[model samples]
Target: MIFPPDLVIFDCDGVLVDSEPLTNVVIRDNLAQHGLDLSIDRIVDLFVGGTIMGVQESALEMGADLPEDWVDNIYSEIFEVLADRVEAVPGIIGVLDALDAAGVAYAVGSNGPHRKMEITLSRTGLLERLQGRIFSREDVANPKPAPDVYLKAAREAGVAPSRCVVIEDSVSGARAGKAAGMVCFGFVAETDPARLEPICDSLFADMTALPKLMGLPQ
Candidate 1:
């Protein structure tokens, strides 16, 4: 049996909370007014596991005139929508309870900035539970698809990279965790199993499988 990790790192969106579709909806509605009409699938393909700055850069490259405060505006709209609809990922609290019972430390490490993390985590009633344990891409020079953020999360959690296990919902996040030298578990709650097969050590949708996969008592 595999040993449990010293630290369990969770990606915030899609994994910790069902906020992707909600956030993307806000993006779609607002961007349509900007004349950058695009499908929700296209938005997810481009922005999942990407930082707000990266999103801005892409718009610039595509010749869209994004205002200096456009990303902030998007975040404001997302948070407004999230207040009424966001909820924690199914079974996530139970998994966290199991991890707590197993005596394993855990933290959130996300490609999103701290403000977005704050807004979503709070709206889902997870902020108090995860208050001081959050880590964001805004804290590092390199975000997802780079080892920096994950490595920093492990360090902050007081664990070695190899002793950390990352739960990710996006391809970039899985790559980031693996590059940090940690084992990665891909959550297919929103992603395709086939696309995740090569990168994830284990692919699962239900959060209840996580404790068992990590060798924690179920």
Candidate 2:
């Protein structure tokens, strides 16, 4: 019962790397300095799988008195903290090894910028597997929830949209995968099922469940 997809596209932050909590912490801390306090849950709901510019826009919409270079400031601070803390999600290495053994082609499609993606992948040893396969939001005119990123990823992988499977951890990423006409499996590691269920084709509690969901022999 092998899945028919030619490629498996994964989201980076929460799916491949355990960086979402760190990202939220940086966001919360940065915003708090400007008197705009955001709860962790709120940050997760609004910013996960979204572009940094998008997060900055959200702050601007909230009437925060941000400097013209505030987004850069945020990126610098976040990356500085992330340099010492980035790690791969538990079980992801095994899951990727399984995919490799099965001769499955894969790529990363992330809402993060190229620099952040590079840092995370390089630091966590995922870069060797994903170096040329990573697609950033900067590569597309639109990011998650708009289908452009996933579409471009499939294209880059030489896979058809309908024959691709997307592994995502955020609601926006799942929506983007679906919009790209791919089967979207939501990773529910740091997310609640109820919140992810509506947008995903299926929800996996962790990467251990992924091979089964992908219809591989177990």
| Top candidate, metric lDDT | 2
Best by TM-score: 2
What TM-score do all the candidates reach, one by one?
0.94, 0.96
For model 1, how does the per-residue alpha-carbon lDDT over 1-218 read when each residue is reduced to its tens digit?
Answer: 15798999999999998989988878767777776777988998888888777777886776676788998887778878877788899999999899889899999999887877787888778898888889888788888899888898888878899999999988899999889999999999888777677998889988998888899975
RMSD of 1: 1.5
Estimate the lDDT of model 2. 0.87
- Candidates' RMSD to native: 1.5, 1.3
**Stretches of model 1 off by over 4 angstroms after superposition:** none
Off by over 4 Å in 2: 1-4
Clashes of 2: 0
Positional deviation of residue 38's Cα in model 2 after best superposition, in angstroms: 1.5
